[model samples]
Target: SQQGEEDPQALSIQEGENATMNCSYKTSINNLQWYRQNSGRGLVHLILIRSNEREKHSGRLRVTLDTSKKSSSLLITASRAADTASYFCATVTSRLDSGAGSYQLTFGKGTKLSVIP
Candidate 1:
């Protein structure tokens, strides 16, 4: 029952098709970030969108945040086999313990995406 839980736990699509993933959180956030991880590799940062922003794009990836619904979605256009990985959404929230500009990050379980060639 934690914040930042992604839906459609797994996804499968053909190469050149699009892939979409969604994440939902429970509390207010300063910003949200997306990351991708290969089977046996570390996570790679994908994109970050501020709470004030509605949508953002980087290359073939498009991210949209809906503060009103406390949810966000990631869309990958023309997904490739190399893009097969687990994608996660993390939320950044302000710390209440007077941590002096420090923040807390909570990540979703992630959606496993498999791109078929």
Candidate 2:
């Protein structure tokens, strides 16, 4: 299994402001992804950055990955109240046991963000 830590357990910001969150992992990973979860729902995949990718962007969201440092950051611009949610970073790791190989997706604790209008 893989493990990760998210900084700043919680955050509060005003609508239209930018929000940033970070994640750090302990093991080698194939890729890193960001997800957003509303109050009572499933997580929605925001973006995926492969180990070889240094940065990626989707709309107003931007993600940066530093494999050497085993860390990643997600930035959201012009955030709105709807953006208020729990953000989590998931890491994909693969391991070989015996003659079989398996992949795992482990998520960090999560960052609870509140957007105030």
Candidate 3:
């Protein structure tokens, strides 16, 4: 599957600590997206980094992508208990056979993070 696999299926850390998660994909992609999902809530888009971009930052979150290695990493600094959630990495690949602007998005099983205050 072109979907990425997240490392350390589960993680636990204290508040104010930094949390890092890694993802590896099997094929080429147009972009990679990170999403956060609370226990019973829907996913919320965290960030999106294009294949042409190597790194990006949003508030306390930082993401890095290594196209050559087909991998990516997400880091959350000064994590809080509210940061606890399931994090997923989704990869977008263009569909060559499909008409213009067609693409497919694949998501990983996700990494569950728990932050203790």
Q: By lDDT, who's the top model here?
A: 3
- Residue pairs that clash (backbone atoms under 3 angstroms), model 1: none
Q: Best to worst by TM-score, what's the order?
A: 1, 3, 2
Q: Relative to the unseen true structure, what is the C-alpha lDDT of residue 87 in candidate 3, on a scale of 0 to 100?
A: 98
TM-score of each: 0.96, 0.93, 0.95
lDDT of 3 by residue, 1-117 (tens): 648999989999999999999999999999999999999899999999999999999999999999999999999999999999999999999877887869998999899999999
Write model 2 residue lDDT over 1-117, tens digit each, in one string: 438788878999999999999999998899999999999999999999999999999999999999999999999999999899999999998866525687778999999999999
Residue 49 alpha-carbon offset, candidate 1, angstroms: 0.5
* Per-residue C-alpha lDDT of model 1 across residues 2-113, encoded as one tens digit per residue: 6799989999999999999999999999999999999989999999999999999999999999999999999999999999999999999987886597898889999999
Candidate 1 Cα errors over 4 Å, as ranges: none
* Per-residue error (Å), model 1, residue 22: 0.4
Candidate 2 runs further than 4 Å off: 98-100
C-alpha-based local distance difference test score of model 3: 0.96
Worst 10 residues of 3 by lDDT: 93-102
Winner by TM-score between candidate 3 and candidate 2: 3
